[model samples]
Target: MTADPSSGAAHDALAGSLKRTEIQRAPLSVAGREIVQVRTEIPPGVESGWHIHPGEEVGYIVAGTVEMRIAGRPTLLLQAGDGFLIPPRVPHNARDLGPGVGEMLSTYLVEVGQPLAAFTEPPDSASR
Candidate 1:
């Protein structure tokens, strides 16, 4: 398929947004917790580096293949309808498994004393 000239720019914006996404952050047992939801399309050869989350991340592979690595374990392949959870502070990285488009939806549980700032850009040193 022909790629739109703006596709790259749009993906970059999406990645930037993901890097900065946040929910309501508070101390222990605080009130008014907020959850953050982000959905973005990913092109081939793109990936998120090794990182950790302050709150729990529950996600499903709605379309295409997503390869994920939890902490130091081997990368696990996930397909449509497959779901996984990443607990707080557990390092993980993910990427598309093929040279095709894919999408995933993620919801972070930021309720009741969740730390929003824990969601951040991964370090540059991690690789696929």
Candidate 2:
């Protein structure tokens, strides 16, 4: 497929919106294990709140640009074709940094019954 000239770039745009679609979900052979695949679209300036997944998450940027922040790690600027992994319970968040909507496909390996994500208090608020 021919990539759009602007697919991997970020654009200056106002805060927009996010949409998610579940591609698939299935139970794994390992007891209590499950896998989930999802597609997400984030409009300019939209961001997921600081949160954690109950399991490991791996994803690939499909289009546009995303800014990701993971605890203790340098912020990442991901573009189309970029891929990433977030370990279970690691706090992180992603924002669309685009002139167009940012898109991604994510797969998660998790324990059955665990919620997909859990929002958390900011680091400074933890001590309160």
Model 1 per-residue lDDT tens digits across residues 1-128: 01134442222223543332222222434455445554545566566655665577888777778888786455679888888898877777777776566577777665554343333454443453
Overall local distance difference test of candidate 1: 0.58
Q: For residues 1-128, could you state the per-residue lDDT of candidate 2 as single tens digits?
A: 01124443221121123566666778978888888787778889888777787789999999999998887677889999999999998888788998999999989898887667677754553221
Which regions of candidate 1 deviate over 4 angstroms? 1-14, 17-32, 72-74, 111-128
TM-score of each: 0.62, 0.81
Cα deviation of 68, candidate 1, in Å: 0.2
C-alpha RMSD by candidate, in order: 8.0, 9.0
Count clashes in each candidate, considering only residues at least 3 apart in sequence or on different chains: 0, 0
